[model samples]
Target: MNKGQISNTLRQYRLLYPLDKLRYLVERNKNKKLNEKFKKDNPEISLPPDYLMYESFQIDYSKYYFGGKTTAEWIFKLLGKHINLSGGKILDWGCGPGRLIRHMPDISNDQSSFYGTDYNKESIQWCKNNIQKVTFNHNNLEAILPYEDNTFDAIYGISIFTHLSKEMHFNWFNELKRVLKTGGVILITTQGENFRPKLTGEERKKFDQGELIVKGNVKEGHRTYSAFHPDPFLKLVFEDVDILDKIVISPKNKGYLPQDRWILKKKALV
Candidate 1:
């Protein structure tokens, strides 16, 4: 068959057996327990609570899929190689349920003060109930962080910016910069080049017409995944922040697209 015929055939097959079902299965196992916990904690809490339910769903799915020492340990190791952790303070923006704080090493705990915040009140409550030695708050990205300027030595968010709109990203970027101390570090993760979207001609045309057309795996209880390529997005939002490194996290031979893990440092003013 010719290339065009082959391409058309594959597209038809993909449409016949869309990948959305696979994504659904993955999400089902991932968020089942977290949803149960959330329900148990606040029986009245309902779906689409300002913050997306799929955010929690993604977190839970990540926990089930990616079993590792903790995001905190990975981050600490990454930061320790460059910066000293002694007497540093950390603010975990978009810290849903304090997963990172809960997994931090005991030794590191004494050296750093951990503060966490999210837009979801239920998540903040869950963090308060589940974890100790960390301060948790429910604050939206629009408001100022409830800390003094230059208060934190480090700030991090995992899969946080990927879900935000461009305007919200700009707002939070400024807020993060405001609260972060000079020479501090900010680590965040997002979908990079590895994310694939099968857009039709119409979709592509819309994107060309300045519409943000994001097509990917369907995440349950969420509107849709609106991830962006890291380089340009980071360059635009993090113009003031100095990007230290961009690491791709994927197991060898997995053949799956890797997630972009960015480590950025707040430049010290001379």
Candidate 2:
């Protein structure tokens, strides 16, 4: 098998979950010196455990903080242009360890209420203790979330859609739509066309035809369980919502891969 195939095999098997953990542990240890320097540099910022950060984003403390901070600023900027962020109800739908969500208070002006939800219990617990000014909740793998209808003025999930099975796409989108206020916006990032270079022959064919490409067998919501979206596929899936903007972020430098950013607005009920 090729490198990608071998990786897929390793991630797909439940039996290899232990191996996966071991691999990350080794990788984390290898990067300890660098992270320690990061800790030394930023003595005041509350950082999560390395493993918890890995479960959501990266292990590098500097990247976790600066990168998440940059992303938070950018996302709010994107959402702010279309919506009134001041005093808005904003949610980080798949907030991992409170990386981006923690910056919500500082990034958005005025009294915007911020909430974050994730299926990872450990991550949620960590956020509860460490992340201030934002409420955190643990969610289920299923589409359901613990919130009242029309509760959010805006919602965003970074890389959340890229880790699910086919069924969850429809289910989760519906649930998100249910909680969103009329004319509310949902900003989400997905693995899209730019990831085609990584797809196999068959996966490429289906993707070219505008289908979602899923790589599963691993636990859902895990980083290894990946899903890819084509334009046509997303168009069909988000048919009910009004697409405000769709931007494809191509890699401008190494270590940065491409992903599609979608801005959608909930339509008024008839």
Candidate 3:
């Protein structure tokens, strides 16, 4: 492992070691029991084990599927004016258990290809077994991804970068750019000013100075670790890209916690 991965692993172990045992004792068994009953009725279906669930989150399959579709619709609407969401190669960069990628077939044309990649092997396996018309791959936590340059027309990550440490942002963004077609759009969300109140005093001060503040005591690449970005920091980091839109949604407007969304278009190669 590289230095960053080593640091992340150490931090992840510290946070998950004891709590993981308790979580398995309480939640894992419950999921297994439910899975057994579910399989009896729908023999072909496969449900991911509890650990594979993002944030240990569990919900009815239909509701989860609907949520994915609705999110896809919102993204389609937002990027539709500038690009064709229905007719190009698109990627869901941290797709967990086929959340958003599962809905792509419904929103896009048959010619459009959908791909999903995540660091979680179990989630990728579950998606491969269950979701149709989408390719899923497992990626390492670090910057390197197994894709050719200039491949995807568009790529988006929902809540993925929020967990990364500040140092990883530029490398990760460059990797995304490397694989993206010139003029491709990258739609990503960040925990911006919306998460300001949740910061510690020191973190808040750092955030005010346009530095990325990371809570690293928890898992390195999961929700346990959260990084907040200020607007200026985002623009500075993505200097090579064209900022098409930066929407900061308020909680009152969305009925949920707000997040700042950035739509960036990669520049055409000279």
lDDT of 2 by residue, 1-270 (tens): 554466566655664567768878987998899999988988999998878888777788888999899999999999988899788899999998888998889887547999999999988998999888898888899999999999999999999999988889989999999999999999989998778766777778999998898877778989877898998988887999999999987788766786899999999989
Clashes of each: 0, 0, 0
lDDT, model 2, position 244: 99
- The digit string of per-residue lDDT tens for model 3 on 50-122 reads 5565352344443345566798878766766668766688888998887677777777756589899999887
Per-residue lDDT tens digits of candidate 1, residues 84-134? Answer: 778888787877655566555363957777888887778788778766778
Ranking by TM-score: 2, 3, 1
Regions of candidate 2 where Cα sits further than 4 Å from its true position: 1-3, 11-19
* TM per candidate: 0.69, 0.95, 0.82
Show the lowest summed lDDT stretch of 10 residues, model 2: 1-10
Please estimate how well model 2 matches the true structure, expressed as its whole-model Cα lDDT: 0.88
Question: Residue 243 error for model 1, in Å?
Answer: 1.6
Flag clash pairs in model 2: none
Best by TM-score: 2
Candidate 3: 10-residue stretch with minimal lDDT? 54-63
